[model samples]
Target: MKPGKVKFPATKKGYDAATIKDVLPEGAAPFRRRLNQEVDITCIEEGFYGIICTPHDDMGMVMVVRSGDDHFPG
Candidate 1:
């Protein structure tokens, strides 16, 4: 996909606190959870991106984003 910003909206309780691993693209924005606010990230590279909620990461609150084409063999 083309370079752009991805937005993650926070919930009412504001438990969406997120942070990106160092493997993400160079320009990826640091994520933070704020009540009723949205977090925007700009990924400039084509690869796998990992995101996790600091407060809930241990509970498996995490996600992976894949940019560009999928290279898995069918």
Candidate 2:
């Protein structure tokens, strides 16, 4: 997902911090997603990204995304 290429639409809930340290790739900036609004994300780095809704994080409102091809060693 290139920078500003991917769009995240918040139809039901919004995200407070989209990129958490250690979980997202380096240089990935944390962004917010307002309710009923859309936001763009930068996933140019090849790594795992963790997205969470600050207010609903305790309720298990979280997601994980992998930006690159799976190249696990055999």
Candidate 3:
């Protein structure tokens, strides 16, 4: 859950946000090591899809998808 204003989706409060990237405070690099990952999904229905992450995390190999074959351009 993020510590700030702005209504989040999912939970009633702001406890329904995804942690996309992890940008720690400056000079705090010794706390945790950085890693990369991705998520795959198949869209059964159409609505809203979201990709959330912490600040400062690099954008590589990360994917939040809506499952469906119709979404593809063939």
Candidate 4:
């Protein structure tokens, strides 16, 4: 793999990342990897701020939108 390219799973799934153990049942191993990977992926995604698990999108994935909200309250 290249220095920048991460060799994630080559499955049909969009993003292949590792899930953390203990949080999920032993049977649901395929979907679960590590929460850290989600964080990394989320950071790369757009319209992202925070997330709340809902419906089929339980991971709480968010799309970060580049709005004019960068102003800090001084």
lDDT of each: 0.66, 0.67, 0.30, 0.30
Rank the candidate models, highest lDDT first.
Answer: 2, 1, 4, 3
> What is the per-residue lDDT of model 2 for residues 30-57, given as tens digits with 9 covering 90 to 100?
5666656777776777766778777787
Q: Write the per-residue lDDT of candidate 3 for residues 8-68, one digit (tens) a residue.
A: 3332222223423332222211121123422222323432233343332254423343323
* Local error of candidate 4 at residue 17 (angstroms): 1.7
Model 4, range 1-74, lDDT digits (tens) per residue? 11121233334435434433333222322233333233322222122132222222556553222222233236
What would the per-residue lDDT of candidate 1 be over residues 1-74, giving only the tens digit for each residue?
78756678775563665557584645655556564567777666766677776667679988877766644335
Which candidate ranks first by lDDT, i.e. highest? 2
Q: What is the C-alpha RMSD, rounded to one decimal, of candidate 1? A: 3.4
- TM-score, per-candidate, Cα-based: 0.65, 0.67, 0.24, 0.18
Name every residue pair that clashes in candidate 1.
none
Which numbered prediction scores highest in TM-score against the true structure? 2
Better of 2 and 3 by lDDT: 2
Cα RMSD of all models vs. native, in order, equals 3.4, 3.3, 15.0, 14.2
Q: What ranges in model 2 sit over 4 Å off?
A: 1-4, 13-17, 70-74
Pairing residues by index, what is the TM-score of model 3?
0.24
Backbone Cα, N, C clashes tallied per candidate: 0, 0, 10, 14
Q: How high a TM-score does candidate 2 get? A: 0.67
